[model samples]
Target: MAFLWDCYDAWQRALAAEFFGREHAGQAVVFHIDDDVAQTIREKHQLPESLAQAVKPHIDLGQRSHAFGTILARAQALESEAQPPRSLPLLAVSVLAASRMSRDAEIQAINYFTPLKRLLYGEGADDNDRKRDALDQSFGQVVELWQQLDRWLRSNKGAFGVSTITPDKFSNRARIGYPLSQALARLADRQKLTQFFSDAEITPGKTYSSAYLLRMLDAWTNHGRKRFSRRFEAALAEREPAFASLIVREAHGWDGKVLDSGGSGHLLRLRLAFNHKRARLFWVAPIATGISGGTLTSGGTEIGFESDLSPYYEGIERLPLTPASIAMPLRVHGRAAAGDPLVAKYSPQEIILFREDPHLGCWVSQDSVEAHEEHLLLVSPEQQAEVRQVLQVATSGFVAVPPPLFAAVLPNGWRLYRNVCFEDPAALSRVSRRHTETAARLRPNPIGRPKLVGGLPVLKELGSHHYLQGGAPDLLLPAAGDGSRRVSVSLGGRTPRTDFRATGYPIPLPQDMLGPGRHEISADDAVLSLTIHERVVDDGLPLGTGTFGSMAEEIDNPAITPLVVLARRNATETAFVNCDGTVWDAITPNVPQWLHRRRVLENAPLYYEIRLEPHDRGWLIERTARHVMAIPGSPTWPKEDAILSAEARTDWAKLILDVTAPPKHVLWPVYVKIARKILNDHSR
Candidate 1:
């Protein structure tokens, strides 16, 4: 509608003023489909730090800023001094922290960290029958909260009381003690009622200690998150929730990547629904329009330097909303079976804004509303691609700031992305997780070729950059296991066979495409020489043979033509021809690691690997030939089909086999039969 575009136009102008500091109302400051959104923009173009901080979150996420030990010590010291507990909230977190209930809990919220049973004994938790059932379970479960509290009380500074029952009852339910029954009653009353001594459960005129009764009340309602913990709270937010949630209308999002800048970002423009009913929710779920912020995962988190191992090293981190994170608009979703009411809806519940009587403030017309819901969201790098794909069809408009919060990118009706960066995030940094990937096989299924000597994994970004004198950065290899140990590597000078850089590959025209300047880098012995050009990426497409673009493994065949040869899948005229054989394993292992030995196959291409070692003027397939040449109980043409296909490929890879070799000469009849059987298969 015209009104929608008009509002968009007005929002663009507002963004121009906020982001670019443009003073004129009519100035053309619209976000063009092409304008870049950067982090920490140029000084003249960015908002002041003061201004940026002014745009705080709409929700009031609570923070617990003290360490557990400090809180515990303070609470204990106060008890030792016999002073009335001054800070109820502090005492609560300390007791909760000391309680076995919180031992395994890592969450920051007072509610979430408290044992499910201990939390149920609090006031607000008992409003429903489901909660009451939880409360009753706490009294009767295998290990009751009252039991733990009783033992803790007996241990604390020699405090003890005559009890009605013992805690350990195995599978049977334990009866409540007089001291604990009074504590439970105080908790059930919300800890506010003054006439607690007159309660039906409490003994007349006998007083209970503050440590016993007050500890159960008020302390559970305060702060979230532990303090002084240096662990990067990947929560994006470091606070816990307190109250109601608001409704959100429409949103705008922007996601960008600058490989050169080593960064990616998300930003949003949200228009919310305002009303008296929604006022309280705003205190916990705050929103501000046109804001985008995130730090580089590399420099931001504690997983430093070599990030190949850290989980958060990737972009678009999915930090789910914990009670310690930004407040959710809906009730905490429980783990329920699919289609259950307890399971949260993927998005939020839908509603309408400005459609009801007395329009609160609808900046855009006819827009429906979603009650500020952040339920289950699936986050992945693929979502970034989808955003860019949809943007390719976007109508011409200034769309600034992708929603940094993924919850804003939902439902597809009101959000748009103008661009997606094609840059590889991996290109931004050099990571060496594959340092152990020493070699590539000569082929997908190789037959006795020396694994090529690729000393180190070649970097993808090495393309398009040349290094002059002192031009290259220090090559930091994987740190040696012993720091004192050192190994030497050399970029050897041109060999006498410089005409071809890599070995085990075929001859000219289409093979060994590095052309003029070629060098083989090797480790140990030779002193280094230097020459640099941009690394090329040629994955041995339709052309080259034996070598895939670069020589990753080292193969030694002084004679190239004889080494690289063509062979047929079958002796038939229509058989597919492929190049094979070049490198011979300089030395094989003591215990041979054979590829395939005996395998039953209903089909002809039984795909077996042959390991041939040199014999007297011939080759003996050392490990696996006997099994393939002859099955244990049957002589089938198909078993021969699998092994010899590989063997024939190996033979053809070496242009022709020397028939004078004893292995072939003595087995002439077998070779001839091999030829006839294969040639007859699907014969034309």
Candidate 2:
């Protein structure tokens, strides 16, 4: 895409150079000025005499001064006539004058003229009595002058040669005027001001009405501050500690019977505290085994929580625990909805606290599973006993492993090896060997000249298949063992027609007799071959039949004149024929066979049609045509010719010739009349 764009740019540059000379072509100049300069220019139009006096001292510095003088002269001429001067020249001259001033003077100018500038660009004065008085006192004339200048600038912007200035260039100049931080601060301030007041009321002001003040306060309380706090809370909730605390508080009263327990205790309750370091919500369950040495001990299962629940905690200090709230599924070790026994072992009781994150479900722990050190919470011994008693009662009828029970059941003579790691050193090597052998078995057989298949005397590769339009190719059939048997063929379940006498070596199969369906051949009781033939289906309109009149009717009521004119003009080149049996002369000697057949047999079958349609810009010429077949003979052609009178042919030819080189006056009114007709038809 980049290469294409480069080629296009090069082509454009070459064209420009060829037409306008290389020195002037491809030379684009862009000017950049600060917003302050734009404001100064606008304000100067309100008080041109003062602006001209201020810049007179530095006016003779360069050719720019002469340009400024010319701008002033134009301004005087427009003022005498009570019209505004062109904005582009005034803007350019103002920038030149501002650049010549010292930094201190520029700042002073901004401060001194701000009040008068505000009278023109500031909030509406009519809305407030005090503002209205201020506007009328000293800035009334300035306001009027500024409005006049702005109106003229907007109306004649193209005449001033400033139409090419785009918003992007203005934004770039704004960016270059101030440091990033200062610009951002200004933007933020503007957003706040706009939030509190309508755009018409946005301006620098030392004082605001009590009504406006109250509105600003309300906006800050309900929108600005609340929005900031929510963002801050969301940011805090991303950390592990804060998130863990949120989960503990939210699930304080969650308790339910687990589903699909697989002999493990299926009931559980969430503990109030959270393991902040591990970012886990702890739970309690009854031990699966009896106590040993007066202490209850059982390993716990550990699973990681999936899905980020931080967004739910934002703004709300704590979530409400209810059955209908947070009943989501959990991902056991990041596996959800898998049938593996390890992952599907237990369905933990749902934690109903807040709206569930669709992707993260509840987690459950079963008895006898060792808890990893990193996942274990430092709970007291008494708490563990209490949890065990609660779970034991919950699982009284469930299966339980006795104390000191073996981890795995073994055969009679077998022994267990503790703390031993089993490793397969040649695992990858065995896999590589297996893959190599499998690939060799799947490899394709080498190609050789076609050979005959078994006792049937047919090639193995020449099996039953489908052939398209042109029919199947010739096939050589081998002779029978006795060297006297004949081959017979039938098509589409029909009686056998053609028969070939068999000799010994080979014979060409009859392909012409087979078309579009199953074909069978047999020497005796056994079927020697079968083939299916088919042609590509065409779903388009038939060739040289769809006409302009039909197509125009197809469109919702189209105009008829432009279409008629165009039809008359291009009649000789198109496939359509007049109703009077006068056909268009073929432009080329090699006319398509289908078209020729359509003209002769169908009595001038119409192929191309034209219509005049109402479009957004005006009238449009719409042309429609059917596909043309280029084959030699038309399948539908008849044996006779349809002729028209010589008088009719002469009249059509003259009409066609007149339209071929129609004058603009003749063509335009036809288009207008067509457009009017289309509008009138649609209105009706």
Q: Point to the candidate with the largest TM-score.
A: 1
lDDT of each: 0.24, 0.28
lDDT of 2 by residue, 1-684 (tens): 334223223322332222123232222112222343334444544433322333233222134214234333444455522223323332332333323322222223332223322323244534344433332242222223323443543455323212112212112232112111111112122222332232112223323333323322332333223232221223223322222222222122122222222222221212222222233343322211111101111224333221111211111112222222112332222122122222212222211111112222322221111111011112122333332332233222222223133212211222211111112212212332434322111111111111122122111112223333243534323322222345554434455655754332333454566654445554322243343323322433233222343336567976444332222222223332232324333332232353233232323322223332221111112122311111111112211122123333443333333232223343334333433443454458
Model 2, position 602, has a per-residue lDDT of 27
What's model 2's overall lDDT? 0.28
TM-score per candidate, in order?
0.18, 0.15
**Over the stretch 1-684, how does candidate 1's per-residue lDDT look in tens digits?**
334223223332334343224232222111111112212222444433211122111111122222123323333454422222222222222222222222223423332223423432343544444443432333232123234333443443322222222321111223322111121111112111211211112332333333222221111111111121111122112210100000000001111111110011111111222222322111111111112222222223321111111111222222232312222233222211122212111112222122222222312111221111111112133343433332233212324334443333233332323222212212211111221111110001111111221122222112221232222322222111111223343434333222222112221221132232333443222222222322332322111112423333566633222222222122111111121212232222221111112111123331222322221122222222111121111111223444345646443222222222123243334444454554555266
Which regions in candidate 1 have their CA more than 4 angstroms from the true location?
1-90, 93-684
Question: Residue 343 in model 2: shift from native, Å?
Answer: 42
Q: In model 2, which regions exceed 4 Å deviation? A: 1-70, 76-84, 88-147, 150-222, 225-684
Query: Could you tell me the lDDT of residue 554 within candidate 1?
Result: 62
